[model samples]
Target: MSTTRPQLPDDRPEQGGSGVDDGAGPAAAVGRRTRRLTLVGASGVVPMARDFAREALREWGWTPAEGADRKAAAEDVLLVVSELVTNACLHAEGPEEVLVSTDGKTLRIEVSDLGSGEPAPRTPHRAGRPGGHGMFIVQRLSIDWGVLRVPGVPGKRVWAEVAAPA
Candidate 1:
C-alpha cells in the first residue's frame, strides 16, 4: 500500500518545551519539561510526523553530545516513527494521528488510526515480501512497543519508546 504525503502546518513556532518559553529569553536556557507534539489525520503524514517528533525532542532539551551519541538515538527514533506511521496509513482506514513526548530519560512515540486491527510481526517467509516489514522494524529498534485499544477511539494506538541518549 502507498499514500501521498500530508500538508504540514507552516506556522509551527520555533519549538519550545511544555508549550511554553522560559524567562531566560529564547536562546538563554533550554526548557526541561516534557513536551507533547500531536499530528492529527496522519493518513499520509508519515515523513512530516517523523520530522515533527525529532524537532520537538530537540526543542525539549535533547542535544547531540560529542562522538555519535545523540545523533544515533535521533536516527533510531525517526526510523521507528516512520515505520509506525506508515503502518497506520497503509493498514488503517480514515484519519490517523501521531503523538510524541519525552520524559528526559526516554522518548515516547504513538500512532493511532481509525482501523481497529492490531499489528503483528510477519513470519520469516513473509519477511522477504516487499511490504509488511514496518512493524517488525519497529519491534526491533524500539526498547518496547505495543498496541492499546482506547475505549472511545475507533482504532488502536501503536506505541514505542527509546531511551534518551546521555
Candidate 2:
C-alpha cells in the first residue's frame, strides 16, 4: 500500500498598498515587534506604506480618542510614512524595504534604500521654497529620528518614531 503525504498550511501574510484589510490582524505583544514590507516594484508605494502603517496601528488599538485633536494621531503617522517614503524615492532611488513596529507608546518606522549618501535637512530652513521639505517635515513631526548605516555597507536606513495617542 502507498502512503499519502501530510498537508501543510501556508503562514505567509498578504501584502497590500491599499488600506483595505486582507484578513491579517495586528501583531500582539507587550514589547517590540517588527513587520517588514518589500517595496521593490510596488505601485503607489507612498500611500501603500501609509495604509500598511494604519493597519498595524489599528491592530495595536492606537486609534484616536474622544476629545483629542481633530487630526487623528494616525494622520501624523501617515504623514511621517509619506515623508520618509518620499525621501527614499527621491534621494535613495526608492526604498528596498519598509519596516513598521511599535513598542508600547511609541511607533517606529524605518525605510531602507540602496543609496550611500546621508540624509539631511536643508540648511537655515526654507519654508518659502517651492520644494525640498521632506526631511524637514520628518524632523518636525517625529519625536526622534536618525539614520543607521553599518560600516562598509552601501546603503542606509532612515528611521523615525512618534508617540502614540493617549
Candidate 3:
C-alpha cells in the first residue's frame, strides 16, 4: 500500500557559503531536503556528484516515482546535475562542492568551483557543434539557471532549478 505525498511548496533557496564537510557530512531535511557533497581532491567527481544527487532525490521521495512525467522530471534533474558537475570539471578547475536540494515544488542543483570564468549558454547556439554545449543543455532542461559569485571568494556557484511534477 502506497500513500500519496503532498505536493512541495515553492520555497526560497538555502543560504550560506559553499562549504561541505566532504561527502560524509550530515544532511538537513527540516524545511529543504538538501545534500552537500565535497568533490575537491576526489576522483571521478562528476559521476560521484550525480550519484549523490540521485540519492538525494530518492531520499526526498522524487524517485520510485509514478507516471511518465514524474520520472522524466527526475531524469531531467539528474542530467542537469551531470552537466553542471561536468562543466566544473572541464572548465572550473574541478568542482569544490555539489549541492542538491528541493522545497517540494522545485529542485535545485548548484556547483561551486574556484574558477573565475562565468558560465553562459554559447551565443548563436550551434546545436551541431561538438563541444561547448554544457551550459546550453543546462539552459534547455532547467526552467531557470544562473551563476552566483561567492562573496569574498574567488569562485562562483552555478545553479539550475527545475519544476517539480504536480
Candidate 4:
C-alpha cells in the first residue's frame, strides 16, 4: 500500500473499453479480463490473497507451462500481491478487497482498504534496513503504481502494474 514512485496512471480507460471490473463504469470485456476477491473480515488474508492472485495468473496463461520467463513474471506478480495485502493488514487495519485485471499486455493488482492514511515509500531507503521494505519492493517490481482515492468513499485503492513477458 506504499510506493516510492507514486506515478499515477492515465485517468482514462484503456482503448475503447472500461478495462475495469469493480463496477466503476460500464461493463466491457473486449478481450480484457478481471477477477476480484473480498478479503474484508477474512482470516489469514495475506496467503489467501496470494493464492487468489496465483490462480488468476495461471488461468490467464501466466505460468511455468508458458515458458521460463512467464513463470518468473508470474512470481513477480504474486510477490507484489503479497506485499500490498500485507501492507494493508499492517498499516490500514486490513485490506477490504483484492482486484486483479489484465488487458493482454499488463497485469494490474489493486488492494482496497478503509484506512485514510496515505501510503508512501520510506524515503532514503537503506539497504540494511530490517523492515519497511514493502513499498520499496512494490516500486521496484511494478511498471507504475500509485494510490487512488475512491470517489465518494471512505477508503483508497493502491494499485500496481506489471508488464507481460515478451
- Candidate maximizing TM-score: 4
Q: How many backbone clashes does candidate 2 have?
A: 0
TM-score for each of the candidates: 0.70, 0.77, 0.82, 0.83
Q: Residue 118 of candidate 3: its Cα lDDT?
A: 78
lDDT of 1 by residue, 39-128 (tens): 553344776777776677677656443458777888888898888878876788532556666646777776667786768777673755
- The residue-by-residue lDDT of candidate 2 on 12-111, one tens digit each, is 2324342233233444333455566778877888988888887777766675445555246677778888998989898888987777777667777878
For each candidate in the order shown, give its overall lDDT on alpha carbons. 0.63, 0.70, 0.77, 0.79
Q: Deviation in angstroms for 139 in model 3? A: 0.8
Cα lDDT tens digits for candidate 4, 1-166 = 4453223543333222222244333223355577778887789999999988888887788875577888778999999999999999999999988888888799989888998887777889997989898989989999988887746668778999999999
Give me the runs in candidate 3 sitting further than 4 Å from their true place: 1-30
Q: Comparing 1 and 2 by lDDT, which wins?
A: 2
Question: How many clashes in each candidate?
Answer: 0, 0, 1, 0
Residue runs of model 2 more than 4 Å from their true location after superposition: 1-30, 69-71
In model 3, what is the error at residue 20, expressed in angstroms?
A: 7.8
Clashing residue pairs for model 2: none
Better of 2 and 3 by lDDT: 3
